[model samples]
Target: MASLLPYGDVDFSLRAMAGRAEGFGRNAIGGLHGPLYFVTTLADDGPGSLRAGCRRKEPLWIVFEVSGTIHLSSYLSVSSYKTIDGRGQSIKLTGKGLRLKECEHIIVCNLQFEGGRGHDVDGIQIKPNSRHIWIDRCSLRDYDDGLIDITRQSTDITVSRCYFAQHDKTMLIGADPSHIGDRCIRVTIHHCFFDGTRQRQPRLRFGKVHLYNNYTRNWGIYAVCASVESQIYSQCNIYEAGIKKKTFEFYTEKAADKAEQKSGTIISEGDMFLNGAQPCLQTQHTEGCNMFHPSEYYPIWTMEPPSHSFKDVLQICAGWQSVCRPAEISTNLD
Candidate 1:
């Protein structure tokens, strides 16, 4: 039931989308060969807002020609080669959200983050030492804390075709367990659509995540959460359960003086559970944890083998869409 998207037609090419940023952000290349900035109001800051073209510092690519909702009153600090490109206008960013500290090449696409209020608000907050990031097709929801919060030593990131709802904790990779430099986090979530959010659909401690073909459904308090020495590689995802069907949860932190580390080593390949879904995995690995394999980070990171047709292709191709794209595409980056 989601149609009607004719924002005056579009034609975006955007430098041929630079190889479509994949796992480990595939070298972001954000404001890809720079210069474009155009967000004509819905003010939250001066001069054509969007926080004055994401507090420009150099490369730009921000786009938007007005479509509605942009309430934020703070926390819009986005620096580093930017590219907030919200497809062909249909934007939405409610009160307080977005803050990628210590930035790097960034690329936040399509947009629509809902009501995010006071203290610790986050709809997108990559922190500490951000790196090449690529959050595409955004559409987060009611937030107070997390909708996306990559912590401390943030590393190469990539969240694709997004669309989460309601909200509870919903995403927090490596922050606690005394930071421990977050073991140089490296994320790569694919084709997202964690609808009924509740628990951190993303909850890692010392990161190295890489889930694929996501389409989680009806979660409440357990849908992928592993504390301490984190490392998840649940491939071909498609869990679907309502009354909490334990899709992995192991929180018992206490690292870096290491004594009480519970569990953190998820390696469920070709996943696909329905109705009473469950993968409650944790079959050992609490001894100096370290077990990752996304082909050991880049050897071919692109998959799709869990279908019921991605539950309607992740609710009609994830979020914030208005079809007909191309208000600007910045030509031929040489």
Candidate 2:
């Protein structure tokens, strides 16, 4: 087995940790007090496989020993108190993606999820009451249903520094219009690159989401969607529509089997629009929807007036990277 630049008792950097994301999942200490588990096989399941580590009842910091594609037969269900740290190797999951449900204290960092087939599939599905999760520096693309979906009352999640590309229905939050319990869902997304995705970057519903420092460009349908009583705070982001020229979309949905429909609220602060991306170009829906502001959660947050300078920064920083602990780079720096 290979080592990944000692990150335990040794002096190292935690910058790559998903918990480092500055959002609702900032408190997610994923397997920090657990033992290390090395994944030495590319098999879908069994010993030395990713499924084995993810299914463990106890906490574990799962690392990959070899770099290859893992063709999953079904959705890889992840349990609580686990950290799937892919820093030393390049691993990709195909055929199916991850299923995070009813778990907590999990961190998924620096991996690639692609080509997930089957209906209702997603690159990383955080569904059904899961909380305290952080997904960082991941590259998700070409999923059948969505690249990432956080629905069904999940909260305290942060998806930062990830890349999305070449997919329709890129992301969905709060899938169920009838599930009114989704109002408790809270997520923070920052430093992500939504590149040429079709729609749902993401189509949100009933969740209070904080999106900052993201680069959303070349959207097919629309860049961002606010639907069904969601409160979205889009700060310091960049939106560049390719041919659509539409940035925001407002969708109405009836909740809890009610006949009356209501849309969500959006507070766009310091966002840059390019390539004829119209900020007011939304569906024929009524405005003045009420929402909780990001200042209600944290009085202060990082926000800069959006600019084209963000394009280069997001393209370089967002997505999976070959990140080793600082112990490996300290010597070279000196």
Best model per TM-score: 2
Candidate 1, after superposition: displacement of residue 129 in Å? 7.9
Per-residue CA lDDT of model 1 for 58-122, tens digit only, reads 98888877889989888899999888888777888988899999989888888999999988899
Q: Candidate 1, 161: how far from true, in Å?
A: 5.6
- lDDT values of the candidates? 0.82, 0.82
> Residue 156 lDDT in model 1?
90
lDDT of 2 by residue, 1-334 (tens): 2211112322254333534546788778787667778899999999999999999999887888899999999999999999888887899999999999999999998899998999998899998899999898899999888899999889998888899999989889898798899999899888889999999888888888998888998888889998988888888789988999878888888888668898887778788888899988443443665666766765554445566765777787788888663322323222
Off by over 4 Å in 2: 1-11, 14-18, 257-259, 281-289, 299-303, 325-334
Provide C-alpha RMSD values for all models, in order: 16.8, 5.7
Q: Give the clash total for candidate 1.
A: 5
RMSD of 2: 5.7
Worst 10 residues of 2 by lDDT: 2-11
